[model samples]
Target: MSDHLPVLKVRLFGGFSASYGEIPVSFGRNTTTKAMKLLQILLYHGDTGISRDKLLDELYGREELADAANNLRVTAHRLKKIIVDAGLPSHNYINIKKGIYRWDAPMPTEVDAHQFVILSKDVQACTDKVKKLALLKKICLMYSGEFLPELSGDEWVLVESVHYKNIYSESLQELCKLLIERGDYEEALRFCEPACQLYPFDEWQSVRIDCYMALNRYKDAVQEYENTAKLFFEELGIRPSEHMMQQFEQMSSRLNYKPQELGDIKERLKDDDVRGGAFYCSLPSFRDSYRLVSRIIERNGQSVYLMLCSITNGKGMPMDKPDKLEALSGELLNTIQQCLRKGDSFTKYSPSQFLILLVGTNKENCSMIFDRIQRYFSREHKSWKQYLDYFVSSVAEVDRQDSPIQFNTENKTW
Candidate 1:
C-alpha cells in the first residue's frame, strides 16, 4: 500500500482547500481555471477513477475544441505542476491505467466528501445506538456546505454536490432524531444551527425549530418559524412546505397559551408612540398590513394604493454595486419616510427597492405622493444621484371582488 500524503486533509465542501497538517496548500488565486478543475475532478472520483472520455466531457463540454484529448493532456500537465509547486512532494500525481484516470499521489488523501461517505456507511452498519449517533454527528459536521460550492455550476460538480447535499440532509435528520429521542436537544442544536446557516432554504430551519421546541424554548421556536416563513416568502416566492407548516402548527398552539398578566400582554403588544412619517416595517409586516388594509377597504369605502419604489442608475440601468446601493438605498429610504405621512407605511423589498402602502389615497393622490418622494430624492440625493422607479396600484380596484385580480403591472420610471 502506498503511503498517504502526510496528514493531508482536503476540504471540498464549502470551498476547495487543502492542508498538510496545520499548514495550508494553495490551489492558487483562481480556482475556476481548467487545471484546478482537472485536479478537483480526479480527486472527487478517487479510487473509482474517471474514464478518459468521461473526463474529456466534464473538462470541456461541447465547445468544439480542435484537439480535445490533447487539450486535456495540457490541463493535466499544468495541474501536476500546480500541486508540486504548491510545496507538496510530487509523484506522478495523476495516473492513468488503461485510460481510467485516477489521483495517483505517493500517499492516500483524506478528503472531507469521501470521509463523509465512509463515516455515513459506518453509521448505517453500526449496531450500537451510541456509536451510530456519534458517527451521524460526524457525518453532519463533515458536510459544512455543498461540495466545491464555487464550482457548483459545473455539470460534474453539480451532480456530486447534489449527492453530497442529499447525504448531509439525511444524516442531519437522522442525527437530530436520535438526539431528540435521547432528550439531548441542546446537543442537537450544536449541529443543526450551523447547518441552518449553510442551507437555510433546505428545511434545516425546520430541524432547528424542532430542537427549540424539544427544549421547551417556545419563544425561540415561534421566532424561528416566523423567520423561516418570511425567508421562504421573500427569497423563494413560496410558502413554507406542508411539513414545515405542521411543525409551526405544533409550536403555534404553544405560543397562544402563555400565562401572562393582561397588563403585561398589552405592554408587549403596544407599539412605540407616534413618531410621524410613514411607519417603516419589514416585508413580512408590510404583507400583513397590506392584507388587513385590503379587507378593511371593502367595508370603509376608503381608497388605498400600493406603490413600488426602485432605485436605479441613469439610462434605465440598475445600481447593483454594494457600496453604491447602500448609499442610494439609505437616501431613498429617507426620501420615502420624509415624503409620506403617518398613515402610510413602507417596507424595504430589497436593497434597491421598497413597497409603500398609501392609505386613503386616490389614483391622482398616489401620483402626488410619488412626486413628493421624487422631488425630495432629486434635491437631497443630488451628489449621490440615482434614478427612481415607482409603480402604483389602486387597492380597491385590485381587490374589487369583480374577478380574480390579474394585475395590470404599472411599472414606471420617474
Candidate 2:
C-alpha cells in the first residue's frame, strides 16, 4: 500500500481523463467504453449506489443482450482493476454489494464538474461584491466545456450537460459584466470570443460587440453584428433576437453622424438611385424590410412573395462540400442579381442560400423568376453540374405577428 499516494483526479469536462497524483490511469491503447462509462455512471450516482438494473439500462439501452448481468459484472471487475492499478486503494475506492454500485471516493477526489458546481454555489452565495467578482472569475475559467461532452444521447449525460452548460453561460455573462464595469474591455473580449465560438447564443456575441464598442471600435462592432447575424441565419434559419437587435441599435447610435451637404446628398442620390438589380442588403436590413413589407401587404393586400433559394447537386440534394458550395453560392448571387428587378431586395440569408422579397408577384411570376435565374446560371457556369433550388411562399401564408421570417419547408428543386 502506497500510503503517500494522493487521491485520484477525474476530469469530466471536454472529455474523461483520470490521474492518480502525477501518474495517469491509462485504460490501455484500445480504451473500451464499458469501463469508462461504468466509472462515469458511478461518479454521477455519487454516494447513492445505483441499482444493477439501472446501470444495465443506461449502458445498453434497447440493445439485445445474451447475458447483461454477466456483462455488468465483467465491466465492474475491469473498472476496479483499473482503479487499483492506478494506485487507488482497491478495498475502498468502489463500494459494491447486493447489486448496487457506488464510488466511495476514499481519497480527496477532484472532478472538474464537481469543483465547478461547488465554486459556482460559493460565488452565488457570496455577498461581498469584490469577493463575488473574484469567485465568478475563478469559476468561469473552470468550465472548459460541457460535462462529459463526448457522451451524447445518454439521458443522464445530456441532463447533466445541459445543467453545466447553463451554469457556464450564466457565469460567463456575469463575469463579462463585472469586467465591463471595471472598464477592462480587452479582458472582457477575451471571455466573449470563446463564448461566441462555443455556442451561437446572441447574448455572448452581444457582449463581444459591447467590448468592441467600449474600445471605440464601432466598425468592428458593426462587422461582428453582421457576422453573428449571418451565423444565426445560416445555422438555425432564425433572425437575431430582439435583444441582439437592441444592441445593434445602441452601437449604431454611438457612431458620430456627419450631416451631408445638400449638393453632396443630391450628387450621391443621382449616382445611386438607379434600381433594377437584386438589392443586396445585410441580414438586419432584410429583417426590417421584411417587416415593413409585411405591414404594407397587410394594408394594401398586395401579392407579395418571399422566396428562398439553396444550392444543391444535380441529383436534388443540398451541396455539402464547402469549396463547391462557395462557388455555387457566388454564381447564384450573380444570377439572382442579374435576373431580379431593381425593386426587389435580396439578402444572403445563409452560406448556401439567399432570401428574396418579391414585391407584387404571384406564383407564376415567382416560378418564372426562378427559371430565369437558373437558366442564366446554367448558361454562365456550363462546367458546373449543381442545381439551384428555390421555394416560394406568400406573405399572407405566414404569421407575421409572431416572427419576422418563417421558413417554408415545401421547396421546388431544379
lDDT of 2 by residue, 1-414 (tens): 344559677888767778878878775543327788888878767777799888998888646899988898888788888767756665655677888888876566667787888889998898887898888877777776667766744545644665777788788888888889999999888877766766653348788887888898988998888798787555433345445565666665676434452234233334243543578988788878988988898899999998988886555787656655665677678667756766799999888889998998898988877766776665422334246777888878765545445755464221
| Candidate number with greatest TM-score | 1
TM values, all candidates? 0.60, 0.59
Residue 208 lDDT in model 2? 81
Misplaced by over 4 Å in model 2 are 1-3, 29-32, 84-92, 249-414
Which residue pairs does candidate 1 place in steric collision? 3-107, 4-107, 4-108
Q: Which residues of candidate 1, in runs, are more than 4 Å off?
A: 1-5, 246-253, 257-414
Task: Give the clash count for each candidate.
Answer: 3, 2
Q: Local error of candidate 1 at 125, Å?
A: 1.5
lDDT of 1: 0.75
Give the Å shift of residue 28 in candidate 2. 4.0
Clashing pairs for predicted structure model 2, backbone only: 276-342, 277-342
Model 1: residue 118 alpha-carbon error in angstroms: 1.3
How would you encode candidate 1's per-residue C-alpha lDDT over 231-280 as one tens digit per residue?
75555334455566666667766667544523442342233344545789
Q: Residue 59, candidate 1: how far off, in angstroms? A: 0.1
